[model samples]
Target: MLDLQNIRSQFPILNQQVNGKPLVYLDNAATSQKPISVLNVWEKYYKEINANVHRGIHTLSQLATAEMELSRQKIQKFINAKHDYEVIFTKGTTEGINLIAYALGNSNWVKKDDEIIISYLEHHSNIVPWQMLCERTGAKLRVIPMDENGILQIDILDEWLSEKTKIVSVNQVSNALGVINPIEEIIKKVRKNSDAYILIDGAQSVVHFEIDVQKMDCDFFVFSGHKIYAPMGTGIFYGKSEILEKLQPFHGGGEMISVCTFDKTTYAGLPFKFEAGTPNVGGNIAMGAAVDFMNSIGISNIQKHEDELLAYGQKKLLEIEGLKIYAEKAKRTGVISFNLEGIGIASDVGMILDKLGIAVRTGHHCTQPIMDYFKIAGTVRASFAVYNTFDEIDVLVEGVKKAQRMLG
Candidate 1:
């Protein structure tokens, strides 16, 4: 019942040729290509509803405002937030985490000498904000160790978490190793010991799963728009209703305040209190359209299709001589991280793959701690999506074979 060919047709970018060969875009963990519907929304906004939202009294202003709020509602249902106000528009996942960190840093919940815990598999976006918070507030940064397979050591978290722990921030799925973490169990355990807030970096997981922040009961969650087939310069930050209401405002400018009198001005309500200045109205509107497109296709079918692709890719890549696949666990995402034997280095292998027109990511994946643990610079990553097909994976495997031969 899942029409993959028809679905692929909706994405025009996937049909293009790259480097005189068909583009095998496997760098989905980096970002996803947008669909035609998403692009059209961008054009339609500027063409018809070009005006500042929530301020102008004209017809264009009303239309723009309506469309903007419609995006908020769409995101609300996407993540199943308790209220639309709980969802705040941010620049991306990085900004979202920073907003929560800064807001909590100023709150009485966290104090000097307190501990904010993170795991080794976190991206720099999740790590650095807490590190900076620790420096400013005298809070100590605690790291949860990962196992040899790159999965979070959930058993060790019981010992790591204590009364001193103020927050426990981690990724739901590792961008580098494609390991989907046991976040629900971790959250339930953390709650029994301390009132530490939990933030899930869903930049990778959101694309592959139907996220329900309310069901998960996480204190805060963040993800990027571009990762979920939306445009750049757009992202979402979800905080619990009570949690968001108590946090201090991070940015201050024109639209955030209710009435400015130079003498103790009162800030606007929940969402506007956090969203300052003019937002990317067009990008956010497009994000809503992107959500509509995905809903029409259904996320369950997408996940099923991707799971098959991942299994096929893993099985085929193992057949290649002198190649080692990382994260050989059953519960992994669509990303396949591996290294070619006899290749000088991952970078060299990546260069060869590039020459063969196979696009993939080769680096630390913004996860330096994990690389240090593995004692390797990085691995070559080929991540898949709904638009990707088995034929493309075959092309990628052949390209890797070619790279191995040339490099050896």
Candidate 2:
């Protein structure tokens, strides 16, 4: 377990007041608050070495490029990607998925009669890109159905996998319900049964778990830096080296090309081929710092501490009359998505709680299909982080109860 007070102290934003009460932030699943360590490195990068990467003869440019490449290496080591060239920087999970759709799908790999499988738990980022790919390739889209309790119906794996399956992309964890999907088993099954390549969306994962792409044997893994307590507009796109070489460049531009002419062009090697133009140099450096900071505290410690809090918080939430936590029976992370009785809209409850300085996310959470499946408009999601405390959970419970009375 982590030291709650000390961990909370590392985040300067947590020490402030909101609406006459101390702030209790529980919207971590949307985006995490950065610690002073991450903030410090982020600021330091711009202040000390502000330069465009990879093309200058100046000292700052060289330093910036070096740092950016080092960040790639750090991500490679962090995720256990086989090579530094496999880690390509992108804007975030959305862009990462789009990159794969264009780069891999357009290579004629996913043709007519091919199939792409995603699940009901995907964020729209994971869903929309594949939809576009299917439209482009004439490939059919398949979905892995889940039970009412939100556990994936992996028992029906054989029903989905076949020789026609070309690419299977899925989330490692559900951002809306916090249900951890069994991606490793899915990958192994797909590998044995079909030639389908797999992509695991780690946007809501990586932050909570230690992942080794090599061990998981997935062909691709995409994640957002902001969800992992790094800056927005920063992300990592990891692909298998062999598969990456087969993919066409997602965009055409300067840095990604090795030789350029009006008639024909040759692209750069593994990652740079996909990384097209000027990249997020400073943000990538800061992302590396975020990875280092998480390592210092340890992911296992954070996960275990949050698991304890989840159990306590869920128990407390269930005590409220007519309150329901989605996916309660499923093994999950530190997220609790719930709706209270007599609350006409989830946002009404959220706003009332916000007045008491309890911050929670209230929406479909970019997983509208899952919301539709549950027959709800939305939910009030309380997502915990390492700095959150049992005391804070108590305050959240009381504030939510107050919101219930006011709304009722």
Candidate 3:
């Protein structure tokens, strides 16, 4: 069991007050609060040994390189990747997905008539890249539809999956609704039906549970660091060795190339080939610290605690009259998206909550399609993290009730 007080204490940001009341931070899905351990790692990197990695023989460079590589290995083991080389440092999940799409577009892999599949649950980051890919390659974009309850209609894949499908991308957990997608079943269906590349967007899911890229059998997996209590601008792109070897480099600069002659330039090996230019060495090291922090508490323990919070939050929030929770019936992580019946505008409710020292996300959440499906502009979203408490949920519940009373 996790010591809630001890865990909460580690995040100094949670202790402060907002709008004259104790802060109730429920906007974790946008970005998580960094713990002191991760912040210290970031400071130590700059204070002790800060230098460009793999390019210098100096002591500082060597030390920085070692620390960054150690971080890579930690992420590798954290996600259970087959090899460290399969893990490439990226700016975030958006860039990683763009890299894959661009590489595939440049290669002969995706043809003019090929189809790329995504679902309604995808973020704009996942949707726009494939749309751009389709424009570049003359490929068709297909979508796996979701039901009224925001559950993905996986059975539709039987008709969608065919020889023409070249790529299938889906999120393991919906960022907007917090619904846990049946990606294992989706992967199985994709493998049995078509010879297509599969990419799982794990930006939200990685924080809430254990991720095994090898066992998951995805060709590529990507996630952002800020969503998982690490520093911003740090992310991971995990791809199978053989698939990574096949794709050409996405960016061209210093570190990605072995020899740069005027006439010919040979690109570097697996991970570096994709990493191009200088990386976020300090942030990456801090990300490793974040991983260590998660391990210290244990992912399963964190999951259990968050699950309890979700259940409690849902039960309490539903007690509010005219409150409708999206994806309430679906299995979810620690997120709740809902709107009060008479409120009409979600931002108004968000503003009311903000004045009460509660932070929640409003608007389409970069998921306009979902909003369109529900025939609403957006929903007020409250996402959780390990440091969050049951009392905080009570605060949120009361805050929502206040918003409803004021608006409705």
Candidate 4:
């Protein structure tokens, strides 16, 4: 069991007020609150060693490089990647998708008439990159459909997996609905049927689940740091070592080259080939602290705590009349997206909830396809984190009722 009081104490941001009431942060699906340890990492980096990483002999520069690379080791071990070089540092999940799409499509690996499959549950970050890639390479994009319950139609997996399928990109969890996707099962099928590369977007799932890229057997996996209690500007892209060696660089600049020449330039091996420009050294260093924070409490403990939050939040939410929670039947994490039956504007509901010191996300949540599938504009998403409590959820229930009364 997690020590709720101690966890809450680590996040000083949780101890605050909004609209003259105690803040109930339920927008964790958008981004998580950073703990004091992560904050201190940032402070220490800038104060003591603020220097660029790689090819530097100075003490501060060496320290910064060591810390940044240490962050990579932390991530590699965290995800159980076989080799540390397989873990390429990225801006976040979005850039990671964009990198792979650009590299594969441009390198003649994914040819014309080749297929790329994603799902209806994908964020625009996942969709738009592949769409751009398809437009450039003449590859076609296919989507796995989701039902009204917000669950993927697994029966159609065999149909979607074609010999022409070059890449199959799916999320481990849905950001909009909070549904836990059967990615390991999905990957097994993708491998058996097609000679396709698999990419699992773990932006929503990473903090709440134990991720082992080797166990999942995906060619690529991506997640963001800010979603997992780390600062913005840090993220991970884990690719198979052999697969990464086959791909060309997505960006060209100083560090990515082995030897620079006017005529021909040989690229660096593995990670440095892809990393290109000077990275976010400080942010990556602080990311190590975030990983330490998660490990200290144990991911299993955090997962258990968040599971309780999801259940309790759902129970309290269903008590309200006309509040229809999406994907209630699906296996989910610590997220809940719902809309009032008669009330159309999810934006207005969010605004009213804000007045009561409840923080929630109100939009299509970068998954307009999901909104279109549901035939609605958007939803009000109340996502929980480890620091959130059942008492905070009570406030959300009361706040929702208040919003309905006021909006009605």
How much lDDT does each candidate structure score? 0.89, 0.91, 0.95, 0.92
lDDT of 3 by residue, 20-102 (tens): 98999999999999999999999999999989999999999999999999999999999999999999999899999999999
Model 2 TM-score relative to the real fold: 0.98
What digit string (tens of lDDT, one per residue) describes model 1 on residues 123-226?
99999999999989899998888878877778887887899999999999999888998999999989988889999999999888799998998999999999
Residue 321 of model 2 has an lDDT of 91
lDDT of 1: 0.89
| Cα distance off (Å), candidate 3, residue 171 | 0.1
Supply every candidate's count of residue pairs whose N, Cα or C atoms clash at under 3 angstroms.
Answer: 0, 0, 0, 0
Question: Model 2: per-residue lDDT, tens digit, 1-408?
Answer: 577788888899998889998999999999999988989888988999989898998999999989888888888988999899999999999999999988877688899879999998999999999999999889999999998999998867788799999889999999999999998789888988999889999998899889899999999999999988899999989999999998898999979999999999999997889888888888899899889988989989988888898999999989999899999999899799999876759999999889899999999999999999999999999998888999999999999889888888
The superposed Cα distance between candidate 4 and the true structure at residue 133, in angstroms, equals: 0.6
Q: lDDT for model 4, on a 0 to 1 scale?
A: 0.92
Candidate 2, clashing residue pairs? none
Q: TM-scores, in order shown?
A: 0.98, 0.98, 0.99, 0.99
Give the Å shift of residue 215 in candidate 1: 1.0
